[model samples]
Target: MTPLLSWLTAVLVGVAPPPPGRTRELSTRDRELLAVCQTDQFRRVDVRIASIVEWRERRGRPYRTIPPDASLPEGHIAFTFDDGPDERATPKIRALLAACGVYGHFFIPGTRVGGPKARWAIAELKGLLAEGHIIGTHSATHPSFTRGVVTSRDRRRELDRGREALEATLDIHPVLFRLPYGEGHWDSEVLFEISRAGLVDLHWNITSDDAKDKAPKEPGFQGLTADEVLARIERSLDFSRRPGERLGHGVLVVHDTNYRIAALLPTLLNRLVTRGYTFVRFVGPLVEGRDAEEDTGVPRRD
Candidate 1:
């Protein structure tokens, strides 16, 4: 087959031919491309020669890049949740936040909303927006954007399709994105794609480690109970340990999909409140005193 035909065939099958002289050490672009070809995003769409041409034209140019601001106040923390809209966990999590009078940034999986098995997810999603919570794309499905196994195209699909899913379901476009597994494997090209997609990359500096139970059964993998998780968070709040560190300021990560998070959040919030950490949502930028403007706050799907 001709090279172009070979490439098309690979995409159709959710694979990307490794670059020439490909090895375990893949270049950033190659890794991004591989991720794009290997992920489930493309398989959900109808691929055609014309569509490929359009993608080529629009590849580097993202169609909502909202950059976040850097002026968060002291004692302010942004609580971000990922891999959710899960029925068992999401509603409880929402109620807890509401009771606490705080908001969270929910990075939702695109596939879960409006999927055959997750029709209820749309309502959960809308409920989040209605209740003054922030939403953003975690991906069409959660995958490591930096893993060598997927391609840049896969990364793009992850960003665009996930946003499209949100816009379609909620009638609001989001510009915030969280790397599925955080920043472990991130590189320049991945950052470029984030800009190309017009998204501000939001990674966390503090963790609740609330998903400890989800860890695989391997070495150094013990689970934490709700009380232990609270203790871990408390330890992280010790400003004396890292004096010059962003004292009283953090982008805290926790997973809503984790049952532990839903169970422990109330306790966690109470502890943080007692410690004087104020909860705030990232609405593109951090507004110092009051809530973010409505345009940047909870969006109405209408």
Candidate 2:
């Protein structure tokens, strides 16, 4: 196998040895990303960083958010993947989720789902849906919707065009949407456009920090290692808990575009399950007033 693929396999199979001793460096962007994860503001379990229910109440936007389901027992969590379906990484992730008897919500860009260049990705999306996973639109070009970055007309196009492409190709209407980079998430106009599209906007309370660029072009952008990614996720899970709670329950975000996240998914899922967490989807039977245990066949832990 290629060295990169070999490393990924080793990680998944739990046989990879630690890397040899080498100098570690961080680029400005790398530091910035890491710093954001370390900040008190970023770590808070408030509307700005955590629960979608809190965001909906605070923002008072017309857009729909996932409501808190009392039917879902404590220790229930959902996995949401953004910026997929990657050619190599997505299938690996789907397999891992399937093996664990869980499903995930995938937010994919329209650009990756249409035309001849994306045939493989189209096939992957179909497989994911067939396997009981949920699909949502990320956007057409994966552009930031932050105010002034694009005109209002362009923002509408970004939302409409993405849902349109997916419908035309997959014949599936995705009711869920997520802002690229979570930018414009709180923007009024952006929320209006999303609401106007008849879609529900989804955000995460926990982040895996797996989206950092690992390319070697920059002087010191070594990006986060697999261990570091897992560590960040553990920290976020801890920070997401409320007072007097044994564990937190909410959406967790990761990127399928980053193959490393897929490689480490087995380890991550194992840890969560061992901690008595039940896996769930963001929508469908779990959140649609049905018992999660009956719908997903994933038993609730006491």
Clashes of 1: 13
Candidates' lDDT values, in order?
Answer: 0.60, 0.65
Q: Residue 65 of candidate 1: its Cα lDDT?
A: 22
TM-score of each model, paired residue for residue: 0.67, 0.71
Clashes of each: 13, 1
Cα error of candidate 1 at position 24, Å: 48
Which residue pairs clash in candidate 2?
Answer: 27-220
lDDT of 2 by residue, 1-302 (tens): 78667755776776753321111232343333333333332211112111232224335655445442312335777788888876546766776666556778889899987767578778778788788787888889888888434786888888889987887777676767888988876566677677677565677778877767675332122347778888998998887777788887777888876666755676777667666676666543223455533322122233
Highest lDDT scorer: 2
Model 1 TM-score (2 dp): 0.67
- Regions of candidate 2 where Cα sits further than 4 Å from its true position: 1-61, 66-73, 147-149, 216-223, 284-302
Ten contiguous residues with the weakest lDDT in model 1: 45-54
Quote the lDDT for 155 in model 2.
84
